[model samples]
Target: MRRTGPTTVTPVKDTGPPGRGLLYGLGRACARHPWRVIGVWLLVLLAAVAADRAWGGSYADDFDLSGTPSRTGSDLLNAHGAAGSRGVAAQIVVRSDAGPLSAHRDTLTAAGQRLTALPDVISVAAPLDTAGAVTDDGRTGYYTVRFRENPAQFEKSYVGRVDAAVRALRADDVTVEYGGPLGQLARPAAADRASEAIGIGTAVLVLLLGFGSVAAAGFPLLTAVIGLLAGLSVLGLLASRYAFAAASPTLATMMGLGVGLDYSLFLVTRHRKLLHSAEGPVEATARTVATSGRAVLVAALTVTAALAGLFASGVDFIGMLGVAAGTTVLVGALAALTLTPALLGLAGRRIDRWHVRTPVDEPDDSGDIWHRWAATVRRRPWTFLLLGLLGLGVLGAPAAALRLGHVDAGASPVSYTERRAYDLVADGFGPGADGPLTVVVTLDKDHRTTGAQRDALARALRDALTATPGVAAATPPKATEDGALLVSTVTPDTGPQARATTALVHRLEDDVLPGVLSEEGATGYLTGTTAAQQDFRDILADRLPVVVGVVVAAAFVLLLAVFRSPLVALKAAVLNLLSITASFGVVVAVFQWGWGSRLFGIDETVPVESYVPMMMFAIVFGLSMDYEIFLLSRVRETWLETRDNHRSVAVGLAGTARVITCAALIMTSVFLAFLLSTSVVIKMLALGLGVSVVLDATVVRLLLVPAAMYLLDEANWWIPRWLDRLLPRLDPEGSRGRAESTGAAVPAGRVTR
Candidate 1:
């Protein structure tokens, strides 16, 4: 590697604040032993990949709903041997063009037998034997197949066997489709290869334009790819140990790429600035790490902290998703701190060697467009602040009407087997049949009712359910072998995830079942896939407030400690909250109101996924803080020197605005690319996150922040002396340099004038 400038002979000491001290030491070590660090990272990557390939488990949708009625009912059913295991239940639909399916009884029987023989299949109930399996038309029919395990936990090869078994029934006049969990397995993989490609391509283009150097552009992308790979490998390993949602890795990838690229970009930008002063590569790298690297570290921790706060949601699966995403962020930060510096050392001056054109020097900010904009904002603070607030308020208005619920297979495209199966079942047996609610009755041990009396009571309960307002039908009760449990399947008139269905579930839990069963010395639990989903939604809604409180409080405290100014931290929290709400509003409008839904491939209005708001708040809040820190750090440095609030605000905004804008664009592009995802949840997340970044960067960071600081004047930096003394010094900008001294404050009034 070609050396950029003279090497520093003096040894660097760890005498700064703890964060900077740690980063400086790490930088020196990596710079001195670049080869060793690189080699070690390579080995780790390999080991992670190898281990994942050998032992890693695939993502699944299994959730631990312990203490919920669903769990109780599932356990009771399993113990009573009413169903196969507590595994997944699927549907195999067959439609014959020739005539009624009953005419092809022999073929249907053989198909059912073949399905039962498939790997992991616990049992298959033939349409010929099962009631409600065939439509009134008699041309369409379905068989219920039960698996020994969740289909998500089954090997990919098992899906092929299922397809083959179903295909065997596909005659020239017949069409077969798989539904339920099996259909979910057959659905196109949710991973968006195109989105990943487009995101990286866009990042490369943006980086090149910003840096004017191909090598500088490539470095961030390369580091992010490595970090993402490592993160996902670990995620795969984690999935083996614990059940993670199928979207976990995808979520991790999105977060990992955004943070990884942005972190490296910060460090690289600082390095370039130091290089202009003729600092040697090693010294410059150390200083960059000490300064921008510290900022990266704090920002990463803030994000991780916010994500970890999801644990407060009281849903293990949602919390695990947060953990999965946080794991990637942690890995990305580690890479930015260590792997990036090592690579910088290896590249030396060659970091810019691959430029398509001569790399432009970092520009002076005094007369820049951002500085002029800041000057404009300072001139009319109230006007800008009002405009910013109004825009955010309008955008966030729709959030007032936000409805949280799960999306059903009916929302998926008809091309998907699960969706087709769902449609067939709906068309034949009514939408309610797609998600029947099982009423599980467990009798009191001391009940005086004999088996015959219990039977009469079950029949009465069934009649009552059938007479219920929203119930379409109620099956005759079936007792467990031990006679301790009785289950009656109740089909609602509405589809699962429909508002009416949710209402019916609550009704059964609160009124109908209790009114009928309580007098009989028995308790009824409404449990099934649909009921469990409703319960999950309820849990998310109940816990969302706690999760938001924890995340916001944590962020506020961290910001307060860092800035030593309560006003600054409070302003940040409030602004971030505004941005998040605005983003939520957009999600509600587009997704729930069906406004421009087709632009993102959504065919119908759907309830916002219940967990989306909580997850988005944590993520967007942390990200909004990232830009806040970057902007305010510069502003604080300028304020300390000039003691002129307006000047400091202008200078700070001018200095960091360009980089922050570029970073936000990069992050937004990364998130928006996920719009192509097949999963509605992923699409919702992508749009919400992308919009939040744009609004935060342009509206909040640029307009609101500057205007607020200008209005607050000296108050922006005010902190009680006692509090200042008590708080640890957190210099986001390292101690290597100071802003040029301007004359001390004229009186505060005079300075403002």
Candidate 2:
């Protein structure tokens, strides 16, 4: 980018005096008007509850790229009153020692007929019959049913109904097992409910442990609740404008709660520490706002920029997530700056009611492990670099084999009406019965789809797709007045079958299919669960680099502006990167690589959805930076007076370390709490993020950063002379380049409210 201006530094002005004035202001505010703050929040909560009832649901379809296939295909289905179809089928399986289909064909046929009559049933394809139904062993038999409409939507509604109907057919003489997308979707909601409960409880426990005070822990949670409510309320309105989906809100809820809690924790902990020195609560609160508040602002901006980068992928569904997540972070940051300080002013010393008693009157002020870490790194920068590089390389190794798959939100579960319908189809037929790929062929200009082209297209598709690693078969192409389309059967096996096979299908569509038909004057677009999933992956890949670049570049500039010393800014940027990377490394190892997939209830075999990495990056980066800014701002504060780099870093570390550690522990627990979710995706994400935050706080921030910075010494404060003259002064009274606005004593009345 472009060079902006030179950095400027100003002499530090002490704001640490005026002791009782600071403490009494907060006490007076609390002693005078506590209920006003409570009343405002209560009103907001009521409004939120109303909004939730009015506009909370009905936005789930926003994620359905299912309808995004060539609008022509959508229109075709629609014209036939099937336009909005989900393009999936249901499978049901029944086992009986009643001999063979010839023996009990009547009971089987009756079951199939009853299913065909279900409201969502488009049509039931013929029974698998003896020819198709029997497994190699006479012990098992399969039957099939074709759906009237898309199996995806069908599962969302009718699968469970069909499953119950089929089970009613069960007697002491027979046994049944159901499998299919529908069956998966209809699985009990218990897992999801359990996951959510566990996640919340875990987060609370972590917060309690981190703050060592229920009040401190409670503040973050309360702030998070407000932020979540506000985010959802605003998203509800936006949902109508952009067709936002239910998944976005669900994901956003966790993200908003986690980030909101963490951001506030950073500020609250720092402010509390500053107050421990006997600064009036109002002054401490304002200083915290001026310093940590700036960090939160800059951090939120970086996160929003990163999330918005997802828009480059050209997939509306993923794009919606980017927007929703970005919005939540922005709103949370705003709440942190405004509501957090206001509440702190009101709570006053009571805010410390839950604070663990400390033997020392003032906060601890001694160099500990971080000091030793800094000394070692300062003495051995090269070794640290080498180790970091090697670790990143290892963590990234899985990228090569990462598979991309889409599990139908509705189909992946094993409860409800839809899943049962799916099992019925699978038992009666085959696993690929639920959602098969639909390939649409459009004739090239001046070249109609002739019989030769049609025949060749069908043959080429079969040749390329049939018997392909994961494909069950490729059926013949069918022609309508508009075009010719073919359906491919994909039967996923256990483990990562859905993800791996889906990835293979997209490769076929983008590479194999185009080559196969290059001479046929017909181009094809793949539309189905597999293709849509692949498209989403492509979108994430496209957007990730842009998002990372934006976040890094913006953060660098912001840091430089705040610190004045390009060296400090560079250190900030580099340390932040290491922290975030290490966090992601842990997430990938544990969640993606299946190191502990069973414990976390994740499918190690399943390639994580493409968007998950980007989501993790956005969230983790912001949180990591929260600590970075909080701790470093304090360091910069000390450096201004001490003028000794080592002393500055040491004092700063001791001053902020305990609070940062506590905040991180709470954040980690909160994120890990998502491990309780029944949704595998949620579990994976929550566990990954939680583990990463914990790692960042301890390994990267506590140990690595100090060592690296200590080695740099005075070099960490270097700023080019010309740039120094040109850059605007960031902090006129505190650190030379603090980006926060100058603090002025608020009028007594303003401070009172």
Best by TM-score: 1
Residue ranges of candidate 2 with Cα displaced over 4 Å: 1-13, 16-33, 58-214, 229-250, 276-279, 327-331, 350-356, 359-364, 367-401, 407-435, 443-471, 481-507, 510-516, 575-593, 602-604, 720-753
All candidates' TM-scores? 0.92, 0.77
Return the lDDT, model 2, position 181: 48
How far off is model 2, as Cα RMSD?
6.9
lDDT of 1 at 698: 96
lDDT of 1: 0.82
| Candidate 1, 15-102: lDDT as tens digits | 3222337777888788778999989889999999999999998887878888888888888788777754456788888888788888
Looking at candidate 2, what is the lDDT of residue 184?
Answer: 47
Prediction 2 global C-alpha lDDT: 0.59
lDDT of each: 0.82, 0.59
